[model samples]
Target: MSPAASKRQADLLKQEGNAFFQKERISAAIDAYTGAITLCPNVAVYWTNRALCYKKRNEWTKVEEDCRTAIQLENHSVKAHYMLGLALVNRQKLSEGIKALEKSLELGRGAHPASYMVEAIWQQLSKAKYIEWESLSRERATQLRKLKVACKEAICNYNSLGNPAADAPEEQLNELEEVFKKAAKTDTPTEVPDHLCCKITLDIFRDPVITPSGITYERAALFGHLHMVGKFDPVTREALEPHQLVPNLAIKEAVDSFLSEHGWAYKIR
Candidate 1:
């Protein structure tokens, strides 16, 4: 076959693969994508499509391999990079995944379809980074508590003695305060999880309430929004009434438990 004929055949195969994928016939989709790749070995789309099929099967290794192959064939393949990033993340290689996702975003430049993928990558990266920072913060807090206890013991021992260490405890406390201020400045601010935040106010929910549309929102915020803007779901734009709102006890309990565990996250603001 001529090169053009070969490429056309590959394109037809890819379309067949897409149809199968849409129908959730993942095995058939993979077979069609494999046929396309065999016909046009250099085509990045075929490799990426096969990678997507592997992803549906939760086969991270195969997804990563196929995505890498696609990337090698076409350096600027956004789908290839995005898929590789997801595969790496699934394999617990977070930093590598983040880098690949960032590269995909840079290459795509907020293009349609890929823009949504880029946004998802950003959210996952942000969540992972936040969890890492939270762990570090807890460790630092524990160390600081230990140091404070040691300082208190030292102060008590000095007071028991005849030695005049009048200003020493105060000075030590001032120094510790300075250290804490510096640490706070250096540390990343705690982030409220998206699920815990109210859609209307964008703050951590004190009392989550579910609307008839099955979307959760903070009670007061949603009530105020309903009163002001007329009864409607902010997210789904579903027609709703104030009476349709119901308390979401499950989400409220989750928020309470999270706050209790991560007290530092419960800022006054």
Candidate 2:
């Protein structure tokens, strides 16, 4: 076929890939985009699209490779640099990633708000000394479910299953559920960034001393966590503060009573 015909074919493949991506048929989309690149190796769009698929797949190395290729082919590709920075940020290479993302912003390119916010949040994390995960609760679980859908659909990768873009296949979802079950079963303290840590901070940063008495032990402990190293918002402060569900006693006392009633650990904090 002529070069023009080949180019046309490549474009068609990219379209097909986009369609497959919408359907959550990630593997199919990758194949299509890969074919497009093979047919027209110099097309930057194909590489950028394929890089997105890699990101969804959680294959950072491949995402970086594809983005680099796209950038090399077309230095003006804002999408390529933005996504490259995104992948780098998530990989904990925040400094270089910030630079790339800043360039994308300076170029006034991108339709993704999450990308912008992530970069902004990372700027905060880079300044902090410690990060802690929020005590995951029902609300967070709901948010994770939403986030999982968005990331998967948006990124188009196998590992993007837990993302907020697309719903993973049932089997993968089940596997993920099991993993979360194991994690929730443990009391392990996990490190979280300022953004997420800020989310649950309300629960940790509240006015535990709701009564004339001193702050409840649990609320005090939770407050200590909030101010231990980093700062949190007042809303988060109030949320983390333990209160009295009992007529006069602390919420921790009630929790202890329930734990004793169930023969679990008496200490709620």
- Pick the TM-score winner: 1
Q: How do the predictions measure up, each by TM-score?
A: 0.58, 0.43
lDDT of 2 by residue, 1-269 (tens): 99999999999999999999889888999999999999999999999998888888899888988998999998867778778877776677766776776666545323432244434433433322111122234455676667666644444565445655545566566766676666444333333222211233322211123322323322333345545633332333333322231122344354434433322311212
**Structure candidate 1, residue pairs in collision:** none
Model 1 Cα lDDT, one tens digit per residue, 113-199: 223454555556545445545667778878877887787778667866857746666776687677766755544445668888887
Per-residue lDDT for 115 in model 1? 38
Cα distance off (Å), candidate 1, residue 200: 11
lDDT of each: 0.77, 0.58
What lDDT is obtained when candidate 2 is compared to the true structure? 0.58
CA shift at 245, candidate 1, in angstroms?
39
Q: How many Å off is the CA of 127 in candidate 1?
A: 2.9
